[model samples]
Structures are given as C-alpha cells and as structure tokens.
Target: MHIVLSGYYGFENVGDEAILLSIITALRKAKPEVEITVLSNNPASTAKTYGVQAVNRWKLKEVSAVLKQADGLISGGGSLLQDQTGMKSIPYYCGIIRIAKFHKKPVFVYAQGMGPIHKSMSQFITKNTLNKVEQITIRDEASKQLLVDIGVNKSMTVVPDPVIGLDASAFRSEWLERQAFESGYISVSVRDWPSEVNFKQKIVESLDLLARSGHNIVFIPMHDEHDEKASFELANMMSEKSLVAPGNLSIEEKITVIGQSDLLIGMRLHSLIFSAIQATPFIAISYDPKIDAFATIANQPNIGHVEKDDWNGEQLFDKAVDMLAERSSIEQALREQVMTLQSDAQNTALMAIDTFK
Candidate 1:
C-alpha cells in the first residue's frame, strides 16, 4: 500500500514530529510492504529524516501529484482541525482531503484533537470535509463531541493519542548520559501561551520549591528554539539552579529523558504522552483542553488551567509532591491504560490501512 500522510509536518515542534513518527511507525508495522509519502512544510528535511517520499505541503501541484500515486491519504493525530489557534489550517487540510477525494482515493482522519473550534466557518468546513472521510479516529471524547456538534456524523472512533503507542524501546537512554544530564529529574515540558497570564512565573516558583527539596529540575523543550527560550526564561527566574536541556534532541531522545524523570510537570500533550510511554509519573498543566484531556485519559494530575487557574501555581508544587508520595499507584494506573492504548493505537493503523480495500 502507498499512503500519503499529512498534518502539521516539517515544523520544528517536537509534538507533531512525534505524532508523525508514531503514525509512520504504526502504518509500516500494520503493512510491512507499505510505501509512504509525506506532505511537509520542509520537504527535504522530512524526507531525509523519515526516509519517505515528501513534497512541500503548500505546493498544491506537488501534493496533488503525490496523492495521485498513493493508495490513500492519512490526515492527522494532532490538533490540526481546530481554529482557535488559527483558521488557515482548516481550509488547507480540508483542501488536501478534497484533493484525495478528487482522485477517488480513501482519506482517514487519524486521532486528531478536533476541537475548541469556535469559529462558525471553521466548524462548517471541518464538518463538511470530515464527514466525507472513510474513517475519523479522534483522540478524546471532547473532540468527538465537537465533531458531532458541528454535524460531522461519520464513522469515528475515539482512541488514545497515537503517540501513546509509540515504541518506547527505541528510546535511547544513553543519549541523556551523553548530554551530561542526570537521570531521575523532575522533567518539565512547557510552551508559550497567548494569554496575559504569568503562568511562567508561577511555574518557575513551583520548580524553585522542588529544587530546594533536592530534586533536580530539568526543563525539557518540546520545540527547539521556542521551547528552549521558554525553558531558559523560566530557569533564569528560579531562586534555585535548574537546567534547560540541550536543544535539538530527537523524538526518541526526548522520550528517554522524560521516561527517566522522577516526575514530569508538563504543558505539552506529547511530553505527558512521553511520560506515559515509560510509565513515568506526571502532573499536567493545561494551556489547552487537549493537555487536560490527555492528563485525564492518562489518569494523571492536572493541577490547573493556564487561563483560569491561580497565578501562583501553588497547586503544581502540591501535586508534584503528592504524586511523588503515590508514585507506585500512579504508575500502576498508567500501565493499565498504556497496555490497552498501545493495542488500540496499533489497531487504529490497521483500521486506516484497511480502508484502502
């Protein structure tokens, strides 16, 4: 089978890259003879990294040509369908699906976090485009509810974030040692939010408390430059010393780092997902509904919402301490979910691939 994959690819964001890796891994494992192509922002780099044929996502001619040669297109595992972040992607991704439909090929929506899509135009386009797909596998009930509310009554299933099924054995524990970082860290994954809330300051204060208690604080950036900048900014404000992990770590390396953490207090959905891949304990901070949504799915603590919670981030430190105390039970809860999710995630690929028949 030849499949053309699309989503927020070729971007420097670690979360999307992880999703790409997971989807590619799932597809190949489901059908070892599968041939893959990617629609990416940076086609050359994505092609080189994943060892797949790639075309610039913005080049409609190239994307159309690629789709013509493939068996089908797989369009997500991320928040690609939502417009609260921006409206451009709804039209862009939907347009790609239409291209595949024009070729009379199958298209699958793969485990996307589909909402908080408030704009009427976005809802209209999303409902229309998605209703036509062969299958729609969303990551959470909230996303499925959003799709149903928008009137996209398709064959959809809610599954765990596909990254939860990512092969953790591939994670290189030696990579962290090579970077001269210690294990058993309190790994933190964070990003910038558009709100005026000073959540960063609150997070810094929480880390400072953890650091004072002799726990090593390591800020793991999910995106290279942007997250590294956020990490440094937070670390610089801390009364106690904290480390910003070296930038440009591969997806596998990032997982290794998070997996080895004593606890992860994270904002990025995939970072928390990384923690789950290895059964590490975590406390999530929700900048978006997807963050809290995954936290709930993983049975972890989500201290507060960035926009609606206390500016002091007192709950973060408290949750971290409590999670540390109950690590054994927490790990068990995560393991049960991880086992089922891994199977479901793999089957999701099988389901998508079977659509070709």
Candidate 2:
C-alpha cells in the first residue's frame, strides 16, 4: 500500500523525529512491502534520514498529488491538533486529512496527543475532520477524552506513544563513555517555557544538591540548538559541573544516553518516555497535561508544573533522592508498564494499516 505520512516533520525536534521513526519502523515491520512517502518541512533531510520519498508539506498541489496516488494518509503521532502550539496547527493537520478524503483515500490518525484546543473554530474543524477519518489511535486517555469533549464521536483506540515501542536493547550511544557515567549519573532534558517563576533556579539548586551528594549530571538535549541552549543555561547556573550531550546525536543516541543514566529529570515529554522505554527511574516536571499523563503511566513523581509556578526545590530534590534510593522498585514497577505499552504501540500500527483490509 502507498501511504503518505504527515505530522510536524522535518523539524530538528528529536521528540517529533522519534515519533516519525517509531511509526515508520512499526508500519514497515507490520507491512514490509508498504510504500511510504513523508510530507515534511525539510524534504531532503527527511528523505535522506528515513530513506522514504518526501514532499514539502506546505505545498498544496504537491500534497494533493501525492495523496491522490496513495492508498491512505497517516496524519500524526504528535500534538498536531493543539492550538497551544499555534493557531495553524489544527487546520494544517486537519487540512491534510481533508485532502486525503477528497482523493477518496482512507486517512488514519496515528497516536496523536490531543488538545489545549481553546479556539472554537479549531475545536469545530477538528471535530468535523476526525469524525470523518476512517480510523484513529490516540496516545493516551486524555487525548481520547479531549476528542470526545470536542464532539468527535468515532470509535477511537487509545495507545501509548509510539516511541515507547523502541527497542533499547539495540540502542548504543558513543557519548556516554566515561568514568562519571560508570559510577552513576543523572540525565536532564529541558526546554525553554514561558514563565515568571524561577523554575530554573529551583531546579539548579536541586541539581546542585544532587551533585553534592556525589551524583553526576548529564544534560541530554532532545531537540537541536533550542534544547541545547536550555541545557547550557541550566548548566551555567549550576555551581557543579555538568556534561551536555552534543547537538548532533540522533534520536536513538539520545535514548541510549538516557538509558545509561541512573535517573532522568525530564521537562520534555519524550525524554520521560525515553527513560520509561529504558526502564530508567525518572522525575517528571509537568509543563503540560501530557507530561502529567505520561508520568502517571511511568508511575513516577511529577514535582510540579512550570506554568502554575509550582517549583519546589526541596520537594524536587527530596523526590530525586527517594527515587534514587528506591530505584529498584521504580524500575520494577515501570518494566511491566513499559512492556505493555510497547506491545500496544506495535499493535496500534498493525491496527492502523489493517483499516484498508
């Protein structure tokens, strides 16, 4: 089957890239002969990286032509329907599905994390578009609930994030080769979020305490320069030394880096997901509901939310200390959850493609 894949692609964001990777991996494993074309912002990079045919997502004629020849379109495994990211997000993704439907092709909504769709127009359009799609698999219960709240009445399957399906056994990172990592280290994944609170200061203080207690800190940036800059800013404020992961590490490499760490303090959603995929102990600081949702799945502590001005340095440090001491139990708890989610993610891909059958 010829299927066109769409999402926030060709962006250097490692989280979205990992979603694309996991989706492609699962789909190809389920149907080896499936022909895949990606609609990406950076078509050449997307094509070269994933070894799939690619077209510019913003090019309407090109997208329409591609969808016309394809059997189906797979529209997302990310937050494509949210107004929080931007006003255009919901329309852009919904528009793709509409174009596919216009060409008499089935469109599968693949493991999207829904809403913060505050605008009525976005909600109305999303409800209409998704209700018409042949099939959908959202990443969590919250996403499913959001769709229901927005008036999408179709039967939907709620699965874990596709990235949960990545196999860490085969993961390898050349970046973590050192004595500090050998003893034990913490991995942090952070991003710039708008807030008046000094959440950064609180975190810096917390990490310093952890460092003084003899734990090494390693900052793993999930995106390109943006996350790297966030990491650098945190590291600079930190009195103790910290190592920052290079900007060029691939998605697999970032997962590998997290896997090697004793604990992960994650602000990015996929960073926590990576830690869970590896069964690594983690502490999630929620900047959004999606972070809290995934934290519950991982069975870890979510210290607080950034936007809510809920940064507690003592609580953050104390929780990290507790998680470190109870690492075995936390890992034990996550193993079953991670395995089940992985299986669900893999099966979700099969279910998505089987819509055509």
Candidate 3:
C-alpha cells in the first residue's frame, strides 16, 4: 500500500515532527510493507531529515497523480483543523484532503485535534471538508465534541494524541547524561505570544522563587523557533540564575532534556503533552481553548488565560509555584491516564489505516 501522509511536515517545529514520528511508527507496525510519502513545505529538508519521499505542497498536479496511485491519504495528528493559528490554516489543510478525495482516494483524518475556530469561513471549510472524509479519529473528547458542534456527521472516534505514543526509551542515553543538572531543577517551556498574560514577569518570578528554594532552573522548547524564542525572551527578562537549552537541539534531544526536569511549566500544547507522557509533572499556560481543554481533560493543573486585561505577572507565578508543590502526587495520578492514552493513540493509527481497505 502507498500511503500519503500529510501534516505540518518539513517545518522545524519539534511537536509536529513528534506527532509525525508517532504516526509513522504506528503505521509501520500495522503494515510493514507499505510505501510512505509526505506532503511537505520543504520537500528536500523533509526527505533528507526523515528518510521519507516528499512532494511539495503546491504541486497540485503531482499531488493529484500521487492521490490516484496511493491507497489512502492520511491527514495527520495535529491541531491542523483549527483557524486560531491563522485564517489560512483551514483552507490549506482541508484543500489537500479535498484534492485527494477528488481523485476518489480514501482520506482518513487520524488522531487530529479540532477547532477553536474563530472564523466563519474556516468553520465552514472544515465542516464541509470533514463531511466527505471516510473516517476521523480525534485525539480528545473535547476535539470530538468540537466536530459535533461544527456539524461533521461522519464516523469519528476519540483517541489520544499520537505524541503520547512516543517511546521515551528512544532517548534513554541522552536522558542519563542530562539527569544530574535536573536533580532539583524546575523546567519551563513557553510558546505563543500571550497577549493576555504578563509572561516575562510571571516566569521570572516563578524562576526566582524556585531558585530561592534551592531548585535549579532550566528551559525546554517543544519547538525550536516558537518555544525557544519565547523562552529566550523570558530568560532575558530574568536574572542569570536560569538556563535555557540551545535552539538547535533535535526532537530526541529535547525529549531527553525534558525528561531530566523535576517539574515542568509549559505554554505549548505538546510540551505539556510530552511532560505527561514522560510522567513529568507540569502546569500549562493556556493561550487558547485547545490548551485549556487538553489540560482539563487530562486532569492537569493549569494557569489559563486570566483575560487579556486582568493578567498579572505575580498571580500567574504564584499559581505555577502552587502547582509545582503538588508535583509528586500529581505525577502519580497521571500515570494510569497516560497509559490509556498511549494505547488509544496507537490503536487510532492502526484503525485509521485499516479504513482504507
């Protein structure tokens, strides 16, 4: 079987890459002989980096040809169905599925997280496009509910995010080397501009408190540009007491670094997700509903939006400290949940590919 996998591939985002890695692992386990292809923004980078055949996103004629020859098109495991990132997100992703369907290819939306759609056109585009899909496996109950709210009546099942299925065993050696510095460290992974939150001040305050309590401070970025950029900015606004990981670390290296931290505070969705999967206690900073929903359903503590105007640097820091204090029990409570999530996510990929037959 020839399977064309689509998502935000070729991008330098570690979270998206982790999701792709998870799906590819599951797909291979299910069907070892299948030939895989990816739709990528930078075909060369993707092919060289991942060892998969890549086609440019804008190559419609080529895409059409691949769709005709491929057994199924898999729109992958990410929050690609939402428009909150930008207006172009919906049309760019949905158009790919529509194109695949135009050639009568089976399209499966696999382990996807759905909307906090802020635009009418985005909602319309997503709802209409999803209505035509052969199957959809949403990653969470909240995402599944969002699809129902949007009027997508096609068959849908709730699974966990594919990143949950990632094996920490892949980073065991790297984790061992970094574990010393993390003995009493508090790690923070920040992403997205929090217009509503005073991120710089709050994070600095949190780091200060943790430092005074004799805890070392480190930063992990789920995405090199997004999380690392914001983390650097926050580190600059604070004293030299904190350390931020280099922006050039690979996905496995980031996981290794994150695994060493005693506690994690993250604004990016996958940072917290990775923390959960690694059994690291975390507090999430929510800039959107998706972040809030992920934390809430996972039963994780979070300092969500305090409204754009009401956000206080001090208040946010205090919440994070309180969450950190509860780390041990919180981490213990999350194990059973994470185990179920891991199994469910793996099954989703297996089931999604089976839909093609």
lDDT of each: 0.88, 0.90, 0.79
Clashing pairs in 1: none
Instruction: Please identify which of the two predictions, 1 or 2, would achieve the higher TM-score against the true structure.
Output: 2
What lDDT does candidate 1 reach at residue 164? 84
Pairs in clash, predicted candidate 3: none
lDDT tens readout by residue for model 3, 74-94: 998888988766788889889
lDDT of 1 by residue, 264-340 (tens): 99998899999998999988888888987888888888888888756465667888888898998888888888999
Q: Candidate 2 lDDT, tens digit per residue, 183-232?
A: 78899999999988888988999999999999989999898899999999
Rank the models by lDDT, top first: 2, 1, 3
Candidate number with the higher lDDT (1 or 3) = 1
Worst 10 residues of 3 by lDDT: 173-182
Whole-model alpha-carbon lDDT for candidate 3: 0.79
Candidate 2, lDDT over the whole model: 0.90
